[model samples]
Target chain A: MDKEFFRETLSYKIITFLKDQIAEKVDLTVYIFKILVKVIKDILNLRVGMKHILNQAARFGVDSLPLALIIVGVSGMIIALQVTSEMVKQGAVDYIGTLISLVIVREIAPIMGSFAIISMVGSSMAAEIATMKVTEQVDAISVSGVDPVTYLITPRVVAGFFIMPSVIVVATFVGLFGGYFPVHNIADIGLSSYLDSVWLGLYEKDIWVELLKAAVFGTLISLVCASIGYKARGGAIDVGVATTNAVVYSFIVIVITDFLISYAFFY
Target chain B: MIKFEHVSKKYDDKVVLNDLSFTVDAGETLAIVGFSGTGKSTALKIISGLVEPDLGSVHLDSRNMSMVFQYSALFDSLNIYENVAFAFHERDDLKNKYTESQIMQIVSEKLRLVGLQNIEDLMPSELSGGMQKRVSFARAIVTNPKIILYDEPTAGLDPVSSTVIEDYIIRLKEELKAASIVVTHQMSTIKRTADRVIMLYEGKIVWQGTPAELLEAKDPYAHQFVYAKREGPMKTTAEAR
Candidate 1:
């Protein structure tokens, strides 16, 4: 009887813990989904709040272009140099463009582009929203009969959605150009030959996949950042925690998304 | 009129407000006074719909309301003009009645009412604590909301600034004819602004009457609170610890 009672009590505790954990995650997911729906609705009704979305898009997409270009450019050059050196040793240098193009487009560009967005834009969104929450600005807005989801989250998500792809496109082109430089200068391959192999290796489907991945990753980053920040409580320390959480969650989501997209498209 | 009936709120295991009820008539200023953590600010938040009571309901005769937060809660990214304008721009129907220049005119006018003008181009961070409070006041009154909630308006202000805010509350009551609920620690503000006062103790109204009655009240808790006495029914944090 004693053993049965102890086992029953232990099982109850374990079940309660698991239930609470699932409930918390479900609650968070539901909140995020609600914000996502509101954002999509605002996009469909673009004429209603066009000004905010345009301003956010300009801020999120245009401002980050320079950084995106530089990071992708450096990343592509490094990969190209390494790939060319390895291929040269194997006397398979002709296939260097195939390796670089596939790796950059299918993997590197979207992931790096998102990393830039997560580090820069995602952290900013989290800090701004968390500060708003801490200072009662979020409550103040809500009291005005304006839903924060519509007024705050929508414009940001829309802006991020448009900007992520633009950054990725910039990253892709910068990366391709970056690969061309190392191959032409160091690998003793002509620009035209590298260009020809890149052109031959590239597929219409791969380009679509890169664009799709960028858009998805952008949405995930913005959604996670805004949600985490909006839910942040307490003081300045909470805002810091929210910002860190936003970046960490965004990276996790982006990597998981990248894997899913690559497997779905490539496999 | 704004009314909270049988309201209760708790944060985890600690109860903030328990079975609280109150009402503020239209065009009347009601002061909520208490020791810190007695849920005075929470009561105002309940009335403003910033927080929903765990039990009971808050009924507002009009949906239009504005709250002046304790920390001012100004949008840090926006300049003074934009912060005040946010109140107007948030309502599409309101925005339809005014052109960009007209909206700017309204924002300028509201700023002037709070004794702030030409500082519209400046950010909230550029302003002093008093100026931020005044800016938030401008934002609150810009729309001329039917109900106004001031949470610790004078809590952190200097004497001169507190006087300014107190005087503005009186002026706004006259001009807008709006119902106001003010939560404060300053005795002078209660005498100056409130038509009636309610003293909260442990989320319950222990004594309630006009400012005059608050002074003469026999309730030990009320006496200790109003006179800022060290000895009475209320225990200091150190003593309690």
Candidate 2:
């Protein structure tokens, strides 16, 4: 009777829920770290295939380029549209390019580009691996004496690390152009003034920081998604669940890491 | 040779296999027959090292073992040639030994051994289910494995297709002279491919004998299984659940 009463209490339920959530998070973190360590070891040993790495790089970087550019570009345009007229009214027309370029380079482009990638490439990677897990392709690979981590996850993580910075570089340029269109048409700013403002406001450190953030975000997204997918069991429904978790977890990790990196560099 | 000694496995609170012991000599095929969820596939996985038993040991004379999964489990991203040649390309001991041209020749020969010819460029998705199973067979023997495990090799196939797969199972056994385990409930599969049979229930083997003894024996479980009777000592997965 005492046990039943305790179980019926709201506090008990809440505690149980918290415990379950914490356990799951801990498990996920451990799995991700294990995969990261294996991937690093495989990379150091040159166990990862170059062909597989290039193939994944093409998929993650080249294939995701157009969508990433469009997302970042639209975000840049929206920011410029909302701020340009107001800044001009305050006699701050010269600062429009500076503010817009600063935001685009330091924050907007990397985040939005990663968001696009998490949706497209990361989710697909999760689903593909989850399907393999369910169908026993992963087991077959293991039985064949090949490490699934080296065969499947290493190439993807390596590709993400190397290719994402390139994607961000292109997205950053496109975002600048996107902001320029809105600023020119709405605030009647000259190209030379806007260019001068952008030139003055942006520093070399910002570009390097952006690239660093992109590389980190890319690696985290791939690793987290693949780890989640590798943990999938059961059947088709579990595959779907794994894919959704991959996307959600990648988004959360990227956001938190972005804040931490930004705080460390600029604070 | 393959040996399983005092193996036990459980998932969460449910026991799947309990104190199971078995052996298959080199060049012999053993069939594990049971209803779904009785640990037939689990036994195969335990032998292949895909699943670790909770308590016991699996002894294999050689480390070279291959598992042909129920659904073929071919890598969708690769063509038929790549799929068959996967071990040569991926396995550490074999990857550096074979040149690309040598791999191509071995893959072609293996595919032809399974009665498939010149379809190496097609993807797994393009093949029929039976053809995919054959390709998986080709892949399984590509490494010249000493122990081969098949999880429902004839499952989800038409009668003709099932016969074809059974034929290949016997043929591969003859060719490789390897110890083999086939997990299945199909009577035809047991009779045609399995040299000896074991019937599992409630995490234990309830009966074992040659295929002839399996058919003629009056053991309640084997009787129920061979006749497909609704009333018997054995329970269906739904009833067990």
Best candidate, lDDT? 2
Kindly list the per-residue Cα lDDT of model 1 for residues B56-88, writing each as its tens digit: 998888887898999999988888998999857
Please tell me how candidate 2 rates in CAPRI terms. high
Go through the candidates in order and give the C-alpha RMSD of each one to the true structure.
3.6, 2.3
lDDT of each: 0.87, 0.93
lDDT: worst 10-residue window of model 1 chain A: A41-50
Give the Cα-based TM-score of candidate 1 against the true structure.
Answer: 0.93
TM-score of chain B of each: 0.95, 0.98
lDDT of 2 at B229: 91
Candidate 1 chain B: 10-residue stretch with minimal lDDT: B232-241
C-alpha lDDT (0 to 100) for residue B217 of candidate 2: 89
Q: Estimate, for each residue in A1-267, the C-alpha lDDT of model 1 and write its tens digit.
A: 999999999999999999996796678778788877777776687623778878888778866677778888899999998888888889987889888998889888999888887888889989999999998999988877677877888778777777788889889989988998888777799988888888888999989998899888877888889998998999999999989978887887789888988888788
Model 1 docking category? medium
TM-score of chain A of 2: 0.94
